[model samples]
Target chain A: MIEANTPLLRMVRYFWPMVVLCIGLLIIVAAVDSTGDIILAQTLTEGLVRMVMVVALYMFIGNSGIISFGHIAFVLIGAYATAWQTCCPYTRDMFMPGLPTYLLNNSHHVVLAVFLAGLLAAFVALIAGFAIMRLSGIAASIGTFAFFMALYAAYGRWSTWTSGGSTVSPMEETTTPWSALAYAVVTIVAAFFYARSRWGLALRATRDDEIASKAAGVNVFGQRLLSFVITAFFCGMAGGLYAHFVAAITVDSFYLKMVFITLSMLVVGGMQSLTGAVVGVVVLSVVIDVLRRLEAGIGSFSLPTSSAEVGVGLIMLLILLFRPSGITGNAEIYWPFKGDISSSGAMKRQS
Target chain B: MDYAIQTIISALSLGSFYALGALGIGLLFSVLRLINFAHGDFITVGAYALIVPSSAVTATLLIGDFHPALLVLCIVGIVVMLAILSYFVVFQHAQKSSPATMMIISFALGYTLQNIIVMIYGGRPKAAGIWSDLTGQVQISSGVSVQLLQLVTIAVTWILLIALVLFLKRTRVGIQMRAAAEDFRMARMLGVNGKNVIALAFILSGGLAGIMSLLFVTQTGVLKFSMGVPIMLFFFIATVIGGMGSLVGSVVGGYSVGIVSVILSAILPEELRGFRDTCVFILVIIVLLARPQGLVLTKAAKERV
Candidate 1:
């Protein structure tokens, strides 16, 4: 084991190494689609945004040790929030015609718009969490799933507010490739920080033993609510970024399929570890990308493939049957290449 | 007044199916502490079984002339068998893991089964006939007509529920199942095979779902590919409101949801018709928060916090 003390040794733990790896991965992704062409850049941007979205989901599933099938609702909200801001007043007014004139005219500034969307998502979560976080285990899971279904029904029917599934367009003004990339990077960093924070530790403790945690004065309900709210914020942010990047939003994007995809990624990466989250996202993303390409290549030939649902279902089954605790199992990945130089002689001996 | 009677008949009929479905869910929860998310899918599976001609076996048993009851029993038998097989294969393995694992696996199984249904029979909805297309309407007064199927559904549901209660109370196996549900380890020590008991719970749940499907499709005259989610929600809400482990609670919960939905659909403004789901969810939330143990007798905790 590397000695705990020493200047150089301290600099190179699991945390910084993971950070470097993240940055390196980002650089590589940036290099692949750095060109300014709209279509190619858009695809690349979409992929990155998808990655961040999946990772944010991973953070929730990883840290909370509970299942959330309703998180996509927040994404839907964020997407609509951004869409409402970016689209021209006439278009927004045409879809959601009751908008006040001044409010419709003043919709600009993507940054503030996205932030507001996140806040709204969090607010919704706060209200929903009060109900959802009361139960534990499978009850909580079912409760959240029910909440999503209710919200889905409401969103579909609330035509006065969401314009009844009609595409609100011309959101192109709200997006810049650079901003999307920046958001993705910041989210990943934030996820990392949240994973190691005190709340994270308390959550793990709760997961490990709820009775003991309660005895230790940890309020299980409160912790779960806080975690859920944080997760909703990131999910909303991802949604806002996606809305701007895609130039539109639809209710379908936040359906059961999206929820399943996020759950599958969390399971594959190792539900218990941050490294597992990263790995799961990368692997699932690659699989999805390859499938898209293959489907495109096949063109007229329909492969009878049951969409992405099959992949997610298969992966979740395999992980549950094989690795119940997941790949990381509450441990962060430590690379040996980042040598322990703090003890001096040990580093020298290793070299 | 005619509309009121129609609505009441419709509500009671709908409640019958919901009661059957919720009982299935509640039984599994009580017996095994397993929330089979696939409970709704089992209902869908049963509907498909009734629809697909190739998978079905035709038999004519002449007691008087022909007994459709025997044929229905056969179909329910098939459903129970399939449910047993699925539980033995998927959930049995999850017995050693956390509750979350079982939930995920059940969900995965549900998804797979849904896709498989789509593959075998295309994603289009199928219409099932529990009763004949021939209609017998009770013309209560003038324009309002309550269909024969509505009455049949209510009768069948209550009969099945009575049978279930009798089976639970009167039979040795039923007693053992109940004992296992109360405390699996203690029941096991007393010589009840916990595994078999759990599997039995699943079989009973699936069989009930199949019966509900038959009644539901007969009433609606059409079944859709995506019918599982809404029905599942109905079952879940009923189970939650009535309490998970209590049979009487499941029945009460089903009636409560059916009555409330029917009332709301009628009295609710035209503009708020779409918000029926919102109301249902809000109601469930309020119920859960008020009585987390549910609206019945105190039982074991639903989930470990």
Candidate 2:
């Protein structure tokens, strides 16, 4: 256990494997795109999305031990913020009648706008955390869901500011194949730092037992709030990337369906481990895409055609029934850094 | 004066729907410690069953002129089928899981049921004759015309409430259910069949939801794929405000939510009407902060798990 938390242990964790995975995925993407196939490009896009989302899930639930139904709210806030800033000054001037004049004039520079979008999402989440983190257990879970509903209702009805639920599209700058790869790499690295941080340890202690942790002088509320804000930041970044990835966004894209899908990814990945989040998101997203393709073939074969949503739901149910603790439990796989160590020693050190 | 009476009458009719939904939810919560987010979908399934079969019967009558008695029997048959299906599939399965897991799974089941309905029938709203533009409203004064549907809704809900009270107090199974809900382990040690008692609770809750479905479809003359979600939220609020395990609490919670919503819409700006949900949540928070237990719980029942 002493060896596990050593600075040397931290330095090598994900250092080589992350680099290798990114390079491998990039080559695979490049090879497929070179074949002049649109499907290849689409697959690459899905790959990037899955990777980033998986990392975000790891940061939010895997590390923090808090289930959030409203993470999609940050996604919407970030997507719209970015789209509103990069779609062209004239287009913004015409459609968004009430946007600040400064924003209208600065509707270029996609990178800067996206950065701002992520920051804005983090700020909003910070505010929400103040009230919501006050709750614990089922009350906290219910409160967060209500937060999602409240935001959804507001986003739908307050259309004057958000073009009244119109799809914001044609952002001048878009995510290219290379940039998506870069974002994925950054996502994995950020997730590593987040999970190993002192704050992360505090959050985990709170999750295991609140009364004992409070007795140990941990600021339970502060740790939870900080984690919530950080998680929302990544979700916001993912939203920004998504906005630019497709050059279009809709309110419904960030609603309950997406929330459920995100949750399924996190759960299937293994709720307790970072590797599970990454594995679950990548595997499920690809599986879903493949199922969508099979829909047509299945229909021709006379089997009842099922939608992606149903397929995912079934997977979620099966996983729960069989492995309620999820695939990885709470263990993160850090290959090449597993110096000889006893498992019980690790457990004792954690306590 | 006429408009005032008409609005009050309409509100009261709508309040009955809220009351019915909340009452069932409250009953299940008292017994099972589960929220049954799928409860509203049960209502949706019941409405679809009643409306679809009744329409088929009405069309058959128009074509072959079937007996009116057969038509009535078919309607009853549809409602019974829906209630039984609700018990067998959702609530019964959910009883095995913990409260937290059940809440999540119930939500999953809800979306699954809703989407299956969409796949079969699409996302369009369906209505029945009771909610349709039937004529002949009784005018209490010059302009206060109350529709027959409104009267029927109120009368039926009141009768159901009375019968429910009598059944719970008088029946053997009902006594067993109350005993189990208070302390599951204790009741089991005393030889109560906990499984059978919980199953009965699901049946009663689902049946009450079925009755509400019939009334609501008639009153609004519309049913949409998404109506269940919002109504479910309001029902949850009602259950919480009324108290978790108290039958009377459910009734009071239902009426309170309905009346508060209507009054807020009337008094607040049109923009702020949406804030009523937020207000309800805030009210629950306040109740938790002050009492932790509900408004109407007994001393024995107040020590909630």
Candidate 3:
């Protein structure tokens, strides 16, 4: 069997398609980065950052088929953590007087702060996942939503550690299209490797048939918890990227609207494929950009404001109606015409 | 004591809205496996019905000028029509899709409805002047008082709940609905009309939403485009904690949340009061961990995933 090949051979074969895709994406981002238009740069950075989040979303949801509502919570935690580490030391102390003296006195490098932000979020996810992963089906989803709300509430009022509901600002503006592109590539690769891992396969099997997988020795809860934490780490880093890019942070930015927009991207892209995640982000980002332009009026033919959201809603409906499985229909865009070169192949979607 | 009675009345008053919302969402969910996220939109549209758009930026009383009963009836009728129209135009086409697809479709539909509301009423919260008489407070004993509207809310909610109970138990269509909720495909094979049952569910849910919105705006005295979001969140929590498909469970869960919220607000230090909802939701997660089937286990929910 093609899947029965040697380990090294299988790894190389799996690597073939993902590397090509990542390189292709990198080239596109580089071209966009070269455009030198500030608005285009802003949109490109936004799209790439979102791509990181959607990819993280795909890592867990694509494998487990659970639509998580709390990944954005990690983004929130990460941004705040990054804000703590990278905000101006004087303002940090003035605003967040509760931070330890060391953090209040010294600002860390932005890159290192980002990594620490991800670690903190991953740590929180690990603890939370233990309780959460025990639940299956809609209960698990609702559990995540609960976790999200709890975290948001706690942070919103932790006035000494945060600016409370106010914006956290005066730090860094380090995220560029190039840096965001790099993060997106790294996230995509991580998601690809994670999905191709034995743990990912075990999780997917549980998703497909939990009873059958349990009989076959899959630790369903553990697998789910693992994926959940991994997704949290990526989302945390994505949030870190977002904070540095915007040069400001606010708790509200990572709330319900962000949750819906990111989830919509994953669903529109198809929930089961890496290609779907990236493709969904790019397509929707471009559509939103166009709609935003239209809303601003391109030479007296302007549409109403907030019509972009309507356009997104409508496109999502049409996608769900015409392609219930999403634009990718649960299939990864592999190296085409090579005829199933690696294992995993096409997903046997029971949805 | 006066304190005890006041707390109970307040608890019931808040619980009424939650129970109504949970009933609608749970009913639709049981029959179709669709969470019907657009139910919130129905509530919002019903609230906005009191004041039709006078201009793009402002609204004036239209049918709200009618007698209170007729005004209420007119709002319920409009929401029901919206529900029926959505079923025909959107949900009917996606009948064969997955629960996830149906849920997403409902979300998008909700988004569309919210945008439409914003387009008509603008994003500001409007000071609605309906049932102003109910705003008056009622004194029961020394140091004991409650809003007259709160009592009316309790009365209206219970009356409606009783009516729904009777309808579900005694009517032919209601029995068909219960059968469909139990086992949709089997019920269909046994000659239950899937389309008709689903349509009836939408109607009942929409009417409940109408009533719930009325009670909601009457108490709050304000309406915003996104007002439904928070109400829907608690309704979702109630449905889940109550047990998704069980009617009594939904009502029980709603009251438990309401009572617990009031208790928490009363008991917690002022600093922690802001976290009352967070605390309730965390408790929900714990309950799920202990009983994923919910507080009231259902025969259908017992099927292991």
Candidate 4:
């Protein structure tokens, strides 16, 4: 490993490549926006939201090595949090009479709504994590899944607050591409820093060997809980962005479909690194966009749209079969010209 | 008294369904350490096997037109074959991977299978009128009645459970599977064929799924591509709550979930009925918190450091 003078320097060295990639992606999306492609702009914005969510997922799952299915539950909570604050007064009055007067009468700014959404989700995670973090292995996974199921059921039925499983529509569509990109960058930087923090290293140590970490005075449960809450905050923000981007939200949107896609992206990217999460989202998004365009009939050689989903599933399976560690295989891509930080050397260190 | 009797009977029927599904999942987990997400798709495949593939609103009976006994055997055989094929084709290749990876692969397989069914039959729910004669009510005692189908379901589940216990106790293959479940690496070193035992478990699991599909279709009289998911979810929860690797624990867990579900539905007000499942899930979390290893802890459930 290359010696660094300080922890900050070491973190920068470890994560600069990921930061460069996020910036590059944002610039490309911004360029596309200048061309006045609304559909492409919206797709990129939605993709950025997903990127934030997946990276947030990587924060907890990568460091702790626990497969959590309940993170999407935070997304649901976040979306509804924004929905309560940002929905138009008339719609709020008509459907959500249970809301407090401050939220129901006056629509809040999107930025504040998104912030509160993350805060609310983080609060929920803090409460739930205490009970959930005590368990380990597959038992913890099942517990999180149960938590997800319960949240889904409760949200789907709590009609006065959540519109009782029906679609709550026409929220203020204020999440432009630039705003989403900003959040995505913030999420990426936060995750990168968190992963290099003392808590993050302790969690990874515990993940690698729980008993040894405990012997080394690492509070495994506390570290995992911290990661869980932090990740939930970002995921919740992504959820708020998704609600505003789509201009409508529903309970069903945050169910199995979201869970499968996000988890697949994270796993396919290699669940062990920040680089893997970002690369997985960007790569899968491009492939999906291509397949969707093909399915919609490009030129005269058109295929059915259903085939796109099949192709995605097939490709994911093949990837898992051949390279289970994912395309990046837990290695970060460093700049080649930076001779002090060799890419292959980083790979060797990680492996 | 009558309401209590009706609830008890309903609980038994529901418990039986969960028990069978849990056993299938538990058996696979015992040997493979895989929580097979595709197990639900196997049930769906079994249900669909009864009807010819078409995009119609109602399904046309394929094997359902056969004699009931032959129909059950044919469906079970087809499902078992499918299970074995999946093991060899997909899971066997990923045998050395982590449990999380294997779980995702199973999810992928399940998604692929569901999509294939959707392609063949369209996404609409179809009416599957199988054994319509069994829908009649049978009076069990004074002022109490139960569906004939429920009675049959209960009988079938118990019979299968007893038969399985006998098979495990008396047969060489069954004993070998138990040994592998106890300690797979040790069993392999002690002259047991790992592949053969695992294949046997898959067959038995698939057979259980097949039976569950038939019973479930007959009970609901409708077939949808996703009908198996709810059952699979409950079965998964049951397997965990019963103790992950123990067959007997799976049964007890199933009954516990079933009883809780039945009582909640019976006692909850009309408006709160939809939240019954949520309550059951919360109960599961509490149980998990109380005993993370599960209520029926097996020796194998302990982590080997």
Candidate 5:
């Protein structure tokens, strides 16, 4: 009886895989860094940024059973927010003179700027989700997309702070592989905790059966909005990570391409679990990196430019066709030390 | 009044593209219960059929230089065939997937198709004018001066719209398609050939897209890989706002989008006009907030997994 699995232990069990995966990723990044593979390290760092982005995506999408294209908008806000805080005042003044007087005068520590960026993004998401969360199903999905388009259009043309359509470059590159991995790990932990939270349970219940959830007295809109804000915060932080990784930002970077890439990662990773989000980003990034290398000329074989996109799209289609739920089959990483799958299932069932 | 009439004339022409594209998308959505992002690429395919496939700077017309009737027929036939082929090749196997999965499949398929176009044609926008004379302006009435193509567009759209309505009301295959759209399982259990009806809807939509690409290319006078994307976006929005399941609603939604675009472009100051899409999308969000089922719905939108 003393050894029997408890809910608190089961929760910890659910949380461990992300920490393990992050450590594994950190080891890989360190090994690549030690080999002096600049390109490889940079690519892995970019992959880490995507990990944060996709996992952030999974928070709202996986738990709430809503597919959102708008989270990238939050990411865009974060990236720009990071840009404002970290840019050299002279360059920013010349390029983005529309920032507030304080933001114009001061440079923030990287950690504060990034977290504030997330907070800003989450605040914005709260407002957007308030307007959007009333609807259920497909309308909500399209509503999110509409929000994405609107934000993009506004940002693309609003030349005041963003420098409008031009790329803001050569500012800073504070997002190294180590930092990106840290962000990824943080996002995964945050998403895991949220998923295990009561709001996540209610949101997921609404996902499974909306009317039933309503009858069960769940505040469906509130739960969806809460998760939307939570994911938005993480995605915004990812934007900060991305901004510094490239040492640059553009409205286009956070456009349809990013939306598609991150959404595909979430969906391909199986959208139902934290592990799927991480796995999808890693798998897709590796595949993209390989294709890019091959396209750039790996000895005798060279593919056409943009072949990576086609290849990834084809691979996604094939994977989705074969396994509609995703590669993980919507399951988490099993507890390898013991046959804990049954016990975990039993605990969740009881909970 | 003259300025207003002039703007409306232009809006009517643009709206015609939305109407056709919306009809195509709406037809497919009804049958499949999912949006097909690749339908735009289907339009692109038909438009690209006008020229010899090449990576050259300027395009030389192939079937495009043929008699107008023959060219239209050829392109429509090609697109219809492509639509039917895509179903069998890609979507047929994906029928059991959720709406979200299916939408992603369509997005992936579109991405592949667009890249393939880039691979074949290169990314440069090539000048490909099928009918230069259509670009000429004509005096329509005492008040308004408009392009000849505008009049042609308005006339053709009304004709197509009426013809489509008649076909849906009177034809057996059309009725079967409608029945299947209403309730696929019930229709299948009854007498409708589900596969055939779905295929027919695809054909109708494909043919409509073909005609739209023609008009679109004629007006724009340039051919590019992503030529169909702008129209596809509007039509997709139209599918949602107008009503996913209702044909009339699709048309209404498409025209609404077109009119809004034109009006916004005209009204907004120069620096702010580029963000008209932002405004249009804001309206769409508001619309969804007010009416989650769309402005009109013959039936409730299908459940998403």
Candidate 6:
């Protein structure tokens, strides 16, 4: 191992570039909003929420080298938690008569609801991670997916709390462009710091070689569970933001389609780096937005709107075929005139 | 006794559908270590191949109007060709990637295929009455009646299962494919052609998907863009529960899931009936936790780590 630096300095050294990129992207969104483009602003806000969720995913998957199909379960939990706390008590009582008096009688500010959402999601993750993180490889993946299915089924049936499969609408639409940007920045910074922490290094070590890491005295399960819970927290926050952004919460929104889209973003950006997570979300979101506009016949040479969906899949496939590691391929964009830094190498030296 | 017999018949028929799907998934997983999320799309393609391409609410029979045997042949042929093409074009390029990456690629491929179908047929579900005779009830006992489709489904499943077993046991190509499934690199070094074995697996899997689609579409009588997803999801879960690389395990896993699903739905209370899926998944999680390697443990099921 290279010489050790203080944790604070090491975090700055490792994550300064990602921090700068997040701030820069937020500034660009803010600039676009100032030009009175409400649609663009709304889209950016949606993109920012996705950014938080994707980065949250990266926090666990990137460091631990595990692909989770069920992180969206946390998102579901978060969204519903927000809905439970923030929806009008009258509407909540009408739609969800099965809810307890505490939840049915109360409403909270968006910030507190969002926080509680994250906390609830984190608690669920704590329970699930204990069971799931014990198994490795594909079994673990399936286990998490099963967990997701159970949550989905429960949400769908336990109508008193989730409103079943119907849309839970008229949520407090509090997630503006600025708020989304703030959440994105916070998630990015948290992800960066978590990934650079000692547990993060330990988790990656275990991911590289579980047996070897165990032999080297690493508490692999503990590290994995910690990362899992932390990532779930941020994912839940994103879910809360999403519920407010769309003014609706539905179980369908947090199911297979969302899972695939976010996973694709992570893979396309570079599943191994924080920079990749942010970059992937921005690039794909912009591409999708442009395609949507084109599909709406914005251009003289317009294609059918359905083709836009096809375009996203094809582009992702081509990218995976050409660059399986993702657009950044484990590298981060450094300061002006300096070369890109390979995160793996930087991580090795830091650890 | 009559209710029990009916439940048994339903369970068996449903299990056949899942078993066929699981076999397809298991075959691919054995050779390529890929979950092949697009396998379900192959089923959808098979279903759609019977219908004329149109935007009408009701689809006209394309191959469905043909003689039964010819129709089966045509649907299977189209699905098999599409499967082989996909393997060549998409999977061949990512042959050496990690399982997670390959799975994502397959998902994208499925997404693309589903969208193409949407563009061609429009998003409205189309009704096609193919083999409506299969929908008739057959009374096996004085008081028990079952759908002819259920018996037919079971018969088809057993025939295919027996045929597959025989082929694997008796044929040189079957042995070679098994060898490849066991260890591709080792089999290649031992003079088995990797491409041929992998291609054969894909073809067989595609044929199974085709058969599954016919049975499913005949049962439901409606073809939607995402019709294959639920079956595929169950198949995926079954494949994992049975054991990733074991053929017999796949069949066993399929039946387990099917039986549990049928039983849960049958017994669930009115208000809690919606939670039948939750119960099924809870059972799956319990099974997984009990035996992480699956119900059948193969050498490949053991993780190196």
Q: Name the candidate that leads on DockQ.
A: 5
Per-residue alpha-carbon lDDT of candidate 3 for residues B51-126, written as tens digits (9 for 90 to 100):
8774344457787678888998999999999999988888888888766667768888998888777765677788
Q: Rank the candidates by DockQ, best first.
A: 5, 6, 4, 3, 1, 2
Docking class of 4: medium
Off by more than 4 A, model 1: A1-9, A34-47, A173-181, A291-302, A338-351, B51-74, B126-136, B140-144, B302-305
Give lDDT tens digits, candidate 5, residues A1-351.
324587776666665666667777878888988999889989999999999999988888888887887889998999999889987667778779899989988999989999999999999999999999987776788889889989998999989989999988766788888888788888887877777778888988998989999999999999898889888899899998899888878898898778889888887888887778888998999899999898899888899877898888888788778887678777777655553566657323211
Docking class of 2: acceptable
TM-score of each: 0.88, 0.85, 0.95, 0.95, 0.95, 0.96
Candidate that scores best on lDDT: 6
Stronger candidate by TM-score (1 vs 4): 4
- Residue pair clashes in candidate 4: A159-A164
Model 2 lDDT tens row, A1-351: 735566665554435445545566678667876887776576677567656766776676665566776788888888888877777456876656678878777765777877788888889889887888877665566657767766766666565556656777676436765677777778777876666678878888888878888999999999988888887777787788888877767777787777777777777767766666666776787778777677656655532344555677767766655565556554555354345545333421222
Pairs that collide, model 3: none
Mind giving the per-residue lDDT tens digits that candidate 1 earns over A244-331? Answer: 7767667776787677777777777777665666667667776766655554556676444454556557777777887766655544
Model 3 CA deviation exceeding 4 Å by range: A1-13, A337-351, B54-58
Q: Which ten residues in a row have the lowest lDDT in candidate 4 chain A?
A: A335-344
State candidate 2's DockQ. Answer: 0.31
Better of 1 and 3 by TM-score: 3
- TM-score, structure 5 vs. true: 0.95
For each candidate, the alpha-carbon lDDT, in order, equals: 0.73, 0.69, 0.85, 0.86, 0.85, 0.87
DockQ values, each candidate: 0.46, 0.31, 0.62, 0.65, 0.74, 0.71
Off by over 4 Å in 5: A1-14, A339-342, A346-351, B269-271, B300-305
